[model samples]
Target: MTGTDTPEWPRCGHTDSGERCRGRTVAAYPACLAHLDGTERTAYLASLTPGADLDHRGTPFTQSLLDELLAPLREPGSGRVRVGEAAFDEVRFTGDAELEGIDFGGFCSFASAVFDGGLYVQDACVGGDLRLSAAQVAGDAWFDDTEVKADAWFFKARIEGALRFCVRRIGGSAMFKGMMCGDAYFSGARMAGVTSFSEAVVDGEAAFDGVHFEQGADFTKTRIAGRACFDGARFLVNSARFDGADIGGDMPFTGACFEAEASFEETAIGGDLSFSGAQLAAGVDFRRAVFRRTARIGPLICPGRVDLSGAVFEAAVTLEAAAREVRCRQTRWARTAALRLRYARVDLSDAVLEFPVTVVGRSRPFVSPEGGVMAEPGLTGSRVRVTSVKGVDAAYLVLADVDLTGCLFVGTVHLDQLRLEGRCLLASPPPGPRWIRRRTLAEEQHWRAIRYGGGWTPAPSGVETYGPGVLAPVYRQLRKALEDGRNEPGAADFYYGEMEMRRHDAAVSRGERTLLRLYWVLSGYGLRAVRALTWLVLAMTATVLAMMLWGLPQAAPDPVSAGTADGRRITLTTTKPEPVNPEGSYAKRLSSARLEKSMRVVANSVIFRASGQDLTTTGTYMEMTARLIEPALLALAVLAVRSRVKR
Candidate 1:
């Protein structure tokens, strides 16, 4: 009923638009201002004053009505709309609305309000919270240069036009939960309070460039249909999250800085992800983040960890980070991925590679893995190294120009298929009495010290270093890999390692171990030609000495007759002399003639030939043994030389 003719003392039910009215009736009038007659409405309008507390909940206003309602609030000097606590909940503005330059003194709410035209509230300062929860704007909405002392909420608000916001500072929490907008631009905003856009949907490009959040900023599950750019944005306080956000186009975080942890966990980007010129002081997580296109996530300074664990990339990606750590555990790549890093301990455990992937080190400005060059200012050239590749199928994995001095190859699959290019540094044995002469794995050294030195070098914490039995296969596989790569000379070291492991392994048969030990003692596991040749020389020397001392007789055996014929009466007896040891001092036994004879016998014995001169039993046995053992040592020397020089 109209307030001018109403007789009842009850409140007005709703406005002309059928929205239930919550505004109080004026004086004795039973209806609100909208329901009052022209005379009564004019009387009610006169009662309103500037900066007065306003509650127009569920009120529907046309453009003229909105203008009339806002006309009184204009500040006397500044002519800007100034108001105290205001509630516009469920209010509808039928046409374009301009509420810009408004100074709010206390709490203001426009929750569930509908704006058929652009809603402009630029340069507004709110003393208390400003809420626009579930508000719908058919046109653009602007909140640029706005300052809210208390919490500001736009949760579930749907803005049809560009949602432009540049908050000067937000004192309390800011929420954009489940809001849908187009062309979101929040650039150059400084937010002092924590902000969240969780589940917010942006239909067009969303740019947060140069926005600084002193507190946390969350974009969790905020799907952006167009490009998402956070270039130069700073998150200095709490962790900035983008976890589960699905970005349709390119997402650029170029020149951005996140002091706290920045997460992109499970985020699906349909285009490129670039983080060039950014510095993530705390860790940056890309765990399970799938990029349908290339991800250029480098040329950045990450003092903290960068994890790409379980992330999937559709195309080539190059990461050049000065990071503390980078983990690619179970990360899958459809194409190539190049990691040019410095001072980062990369772990690629269980990573799946459909194409080739490279982990390279760079201390200087060099071409990136994707064949592009990055800005090289202040490049430290701190070596980028791989610490572990456990459980990685290395068939398509490559290490180029990286420091692998501490890379652990335990539990790696298809390890023999790994491709090595450029100067891939590996650990070598420490300086010892004997030259190690070859590069080896650090794990091998660690395990060897434990097995042989009775716990000399400590194993990794909480895990036992593999014993010889386990290391033997690793060496064998690597040797095969190098050999398959046509690096036989390089394989020699691994071959030696394999033999050493086998000799120490209890899994090996005792006879094999014994033979291996003998081989090692005599020939350095058939890889040291000097050891084999030296043993060969010693055997020949012993043979010569034995022959000179006991094999030669004092005089040449002479024929003597002693038999007499007993039956035929015409037989002559004959006896043959045998060789005897020379009856003289040891010096006499080393006579030049005897030495010449013994040397000749020993030289021929090296060829497995018997000397024509008869020798004593001990000398004959010595010659036979020398022929067998010395020639074997000589063959070992030959094999060692071949192993060193083979193609």
Candidate 2:
């Protein structure tokens, strides 16, 4: 029954959009060219010519049949197959398909194509855009050494095996939006326009070694489940954005270069994120980025601002970028960290540092992860300067070899616990017109300008401003911190600042304020030995002049002779004439005898001893007055001197 009935062409089962095929069939085989087999498929392909347009939609092909179709198009001299526009939509490849060294003269569409085996288009040239939208590739998809003149779209394409683009260059953008792939290797691929992988998912490792992206590279919202390596990759002139990228493993861009901005805003890295030896010529922003493991963000050369504001680190991190400015504001570090920066102004305001964080200005370049030095020429400076530590928890903060002269520590918490090493400096107030004051805080100057108008510039709008009530404790804590390090002299400036703040504090009692003011005026709060000595010398000179002018008598007094009558057992008292003012203003009062007597009286008065000399009626009162005030000035001078020399 089967032989006579002849199977009836099997009713050509292919369908599209719920419509049965209207495809032509020939020679009792009753199938289209794509479905033909054996001698018949070969016979039809033998008639195909080079550079001819072909339509093979929904074709199901074996490797041999596919090769046969491209055979006639091969160029004779160099074996370069050149074809016109081709459509392989919904085509199913049964085995590995090699289209290497082929040139497509027009657009190439493999839309919704399925490759059961590897798809190789290596060394191929596509004159127009290459579209593989919604294609499914089970084995490796090779576009290596290929050149696409127009855009390359892999939208929603899935590759179970590796996707490679080794040495492939693209003229237009490479769009991989929502693509789901396995391991990807793009080593040495150069993309002329933007290369976007937005919302794509990578299940295995990604290696983009030495790739050059001429415009930009965007990985926004990409979900990478494996480690991504971009060692030596270059983003030439545009920004490289990794915003909202979720990296499951380590992402190392070692030796990579970003000529423009590189942003990782809100990115989450489950493993270490490294940029060892990377050169970021423009700014790099990592705001709100989270690192679950250790991050090695340094040994990179970043000349622009490197911002890590609002970033949260769950483990230790070492950052050694030579950035101009580094902002760690509101960054939360859960474990011990180190920042070895060069020529950067670090801002750690509101940083939640749970463990100790050591920051230092490195004199030498940082060592890269591979044990190489990250040295760059022409850096202006190699010091890490801390500009603002306001709102920082300074309990476990350590600073070494840093410039803090202009640093603002107004809102720092637990400041007394801060540890500073290697020449930390605080700024001093500028010289006053009539006097020189000790070092003071920057916030104090602002407050003084507001209150007393010393011409200090006002803080910018929304900038934090501090008053004496806020500054006094700051000075006290800083003073204590320096003192704990056995830097007594270093703490002197802070102590003076504390007293000045106290004198200006409205919260202090009026009497205490007056006393502090007096302390400041008299001897610079007992810190200035020169001021006290100056006062001491002036007081001594005035006392000697007054004693010579009116305090001493005209001549030496004589003791009474009556005491000799009872020389054997008599208790005798010496009696002198009543003291009176010298009456001669013409010339008689000026004498050598009076000068000698005045010297003795003044000397004795200074030491609280009696000067045995005959005096005028006004002289006795003057001697008592001189004894009281002169000694206090001398004592102040001595105290000032001792305060400076003490440990």
What's model 1's lDDT at 539?
A: 88
lDDT of 1 by residue, 1-647 (tens): 22233323344555547644654455567766556678877776677777887766656667687677677788789888878998777767888877677888999898888899988877789999989999999999998778999998999999999998878878888899999999999999878888999999999999999988889799999999989988999998799999999999988887788888999999998877677767676788999999887567657667778899999998788877777788999999999888888777888988898999988876665443466655533334467788788888899998877787777887999988987777777877656755456677767768767655642344567644788888888888888988998988888988998898899899889999999999899998889999999999988888888888887777777788976667767676787777765788888799899999999998888875778777777777887787888889899999999999999
Clashing pairs in 1: 363-381, 563-573
- Model 2 worst lDDT window (10 residues): 1-10
Q: Per-prediction TM-score, please?
A: 0.87, 0.87
Model 2 lDDT tens row, 1-647: 11123222333344668854433343355666665667877776666677876666555778877777889888788888888987776667888877878888987888778899988887888888888889999999988688888888899998988898774788898998899888888899889988998999989888888999999899899888888888899999899999999988888888898989999999988876677778777889999999887566657677788899999999888876787889999999999999888888899989998999999888887777577777664357746789889899999999999988657888799999889899765555656775365666668766766766655545546667787888999999998998898877778788888988888889999999998987777788888877777876677676666677787755455555445446577765677556556667725654676667777787787776878666665677777776786676667778777766668
lDDT of 1 at 13: 59
Q: How big is the positional error of residue 133 in model 1, measured in Å on the Cα after superposition?
A: 0.6
